[model samples]
Target: MAPPSVLISGAGPTGLILALVLLQNGVSVRIIEKELKHRIGSRGSGVQPRTLELYNILGILPDIQKEGAPIATMAKYNPGEIEPSPSPKLPSGSSPPQTYRTYPNGLSISQERHEEILRDQLQKLSCSVELGSELRSFEQFSDHVVAKIVKTNADGKQVEESTNFHWLVGVDGARSIVHKQLGLSFLGETQEEHIALGDIAVEGVDPRFWHMWHVPPKLLVLRSSSSTSKVFMFAYTGRPEHLAENPPTREEFIEEFYDVTGRRDITFGPATWMSNWRPNLRMVDTMRSGRVFIAGGSPFMSPSRPSLNTHVPDATHCHSPTGGQGLNSSVQDAANLGGKLALVHKGLAPVALLDTYSEERIRVIAHMLKVTTELYHKMFSGAGPADPSAWKRGSDLNMLGVNYCGSLIVFEDAAGAGVSSDAYSRAAGSTVQAAYCAPDASGLVRAGSADAPTTLFAVFHVSMHTMLLFGGDAGAHAPVATVLGRFPEAAVRTVLVIPQGQTAADDGALFSAVLEDQAGHAYAGYGLTAGELAVVVVRPNGVVGAVVSNARGIERYFQKVLV
Candidate 1:
């Protein structure tokens, strides 16, 4: 059989991440963008905690932190009132710490800069996106997909080409040609909520706060955005009866701004970009069709017998930018699908392994869509609570709780029973469940006489499955060593986490790495007993695939994933 190759449509962050991860794992990929040039402006500008963790694994968190800022505090105002309303006091109380996370809060960075980082990462891997190249159509066979493509040259000439690939992925926006070609229905309603939004150079506006006014006829907002000079993003949501069909011109925007804020003291400069946004609430039933699959905004869904087809996962999107999760969710979708595809390409797992991508992500997206939709209604519906406390950030938006608890590939031994996903929190430190991302914990590795401290986050392997053997005594370590030897070297890895005061050495032949639990964080974080031996199998995507007590359990878990 020919080696697996992939063709991805769209050069947005989703496609770039999917391509980058696939290429890093030695898979061949060709990515195409229909746009003539790179996109500009802050479209989906919020990066969630879960996405930050994914960025850490991809080795791009440093760059993202350098280029982004924290969420801006929203300052409220009323029409004809020059002074701002008092900042709503948040409920005074203490809650459980969010321990399952490293990057706790969401980051605010424009979508354009996010894509630049992804493209740069892809370039470092010796892969680049082909601009002005579009997927016109495709036909999928039992084994491969033939795609018809059109490319625009430097001279503005267009050429057509046809190519075949082992799989096809569509990350194109909502109006996806691939989805249309597959004849999938985008079954949902588009709301009447319309807003005029734009990026504008401005003066006399504080960058630290997101300014807003709940006027009679409309709600107006202004927040800082990264630009050549000081620029702000403005959104004007007028009454449904008064919204214009076309985007407002600069002159009209200035007049509306003055009327709403009653602040001629603030000056509005030229608009950098502007658009009319209509809140769309729709999605396809599934996210795959034959050998061609779609993710992000493509509304193509998988058939009932999805195990027989090649796979890529999906992420949901909404028209309203209530919470900045659109791009973050899409990147996560790519992360999950890319991890599975990498294993399949390496021949360590069968193609059936790809089926879980759709199964797991569909559940996540379904939950997310429901949550975001509820928030949208709560905010826009005239009946929404006026208290700022009512709109406070919650655990749902953080995305740290997303998991594949019921996925086919994840197996938990009897010891793991009752340790459900809800019990697996960084704050709880009582249980860590299978099918969720492994929690990071602190430990120490013996170096000569001195012990060096480290963390579970640092030891996670981005491209290989990490097998953490707790209670790393001689008896615990022996079974893991034998199991590691049985699997392909590139397929699995072993990290022996020993108890306190135990001297451990890196025997390159046996353990990939050895660490002593000098701090007991690993023991507590993973909810393991110092007296009992346990093994945790974490997938390339950082999700715990299984938790078992013996070597027999380890072998059984691998049987489900490996061919």
Candidate 2:
């Protein structure tokens, strides 16, 4: 069967990332964006390391980090003084988020800068984002998926069209037209209180300083991640009822923003982006209603920073300026999804595996909501935090390196054995990725020969199966190879060799090819054990049938494959 060709909506970081990963894995994808134009205003100024790693996989993070300001150069505030919080760093061998450190400490590029990085990555994959197209409706059939699209002309006339695809991912965002068209319910809160947003350049402050005023009634958080002059500020008020018009005005913004900071000298002008963003705590009960999934800030919610219960660790309540977690969460979501899709394509995972995409994500997003919500209330709620000081610490640097505690797509490792984990397996668990693995000239280069077992255990895969021979002494198994070669019909090909102790120049050479190896015995199941160490892989469906190290004979093994 042919793999599904995916149609993705939205060109934000998440959508662009999904497109890049799918293309890399031999999957086809098309992206559609509703925006007819691009934004100059920056939003969501923080990016985290995990997100950067995902970009690394996509091959775009390095340039981005260089192009953007260093996290250490970005300002960090907690209390009396302001300083730069170092980039996010991660401690190895841990699952906690606290172990992770912000790279460049924490950056302050608006959403636009982040998107530029994503767009460039997409281009590297030979793909582009189609603009001014909206996914109005989509329907799923047993074998295919289709969507209704509305496109606007040069003169701004709207025209409707339909697109066909093998699958449709609605990264169309929270207010996704696709979500509504699919009759999927997006369940969450429209913030009960008040939140304000202002996008303007303010005077009377150094470009390098991240200012946080511990004011009562409202919190003033200002930081510049892009140009030094472009300062971002926010105000949270319980009395939003006393505020102005449907669409806000610059006059009103200057009044409210400056009043919160109590600085008449500081003036804001040339509003690039100005809108009231309410604090919403929400999530769709299901991210997939048929073939569409909801992502980004739309369906789910975000609370202002420096508040109570915010995923962020400090008490500043994330009110002023948050530079880390939100962007990190979205990038993480895309990485997890891509890996799962690869398993599905291989038919190595259970069908039910698909649903958990939403199940697990909800767990993470739920945490973000709680953390941000609490942080928002605490910082801006007036009665919440007594002081809005900025603080930076030598972080615990816990990397939120995600692991599949219960993922269904786990595969057997190199030894073709049930290698256990948690140190109790006595054998190392299979590595998550290996083929791309290149040998390192590290101190542990195994030069001494270890005995490799002749036969590996296997139950005939009704379809296909994998097997591995832990590297053992090649010289010890000549008789075995001879016995196996006795059956030329079983194209028993040896793929990779895992060496144990210090062995010869290790390049995964097979027994037949290497001179020191016992050529004849690979057939007899008389191979050696490498001081009891490394393992080698055997291709599935070998010509030879049952070659067991413990007891099976060469003749018997041949009979099984023929039968």
Q: Write the per-residue lDDT of candidate 1 for residues 122-193, one digit (tens) a residue.
A: 888878899989899899898789999999977889999898898899888545678778876665667766
Kindly report which residue stretches of model 1 are placed more than 4 angstroms away from their true locations once superposed: 1-4, 80-83, 88-100, 226-229, 239-242, 297-319, 415-429, 446-453, 505-509
TM-scores of the models, in the order given? 0.89, 0.65
| Candidate 2 total steric clashes | 92
- Extract clashing residue pairs from model 1: 99-426, 100-426, 286-301, 287-301, 287-302, 288-301, 288-302
Model 1: how far is 96 from its true place, Å? Answer: 5.4
lDDT score of model 2? 0.47
Name the 10 consecutive residues with the lowest summed lDDT in model 1.
303-312
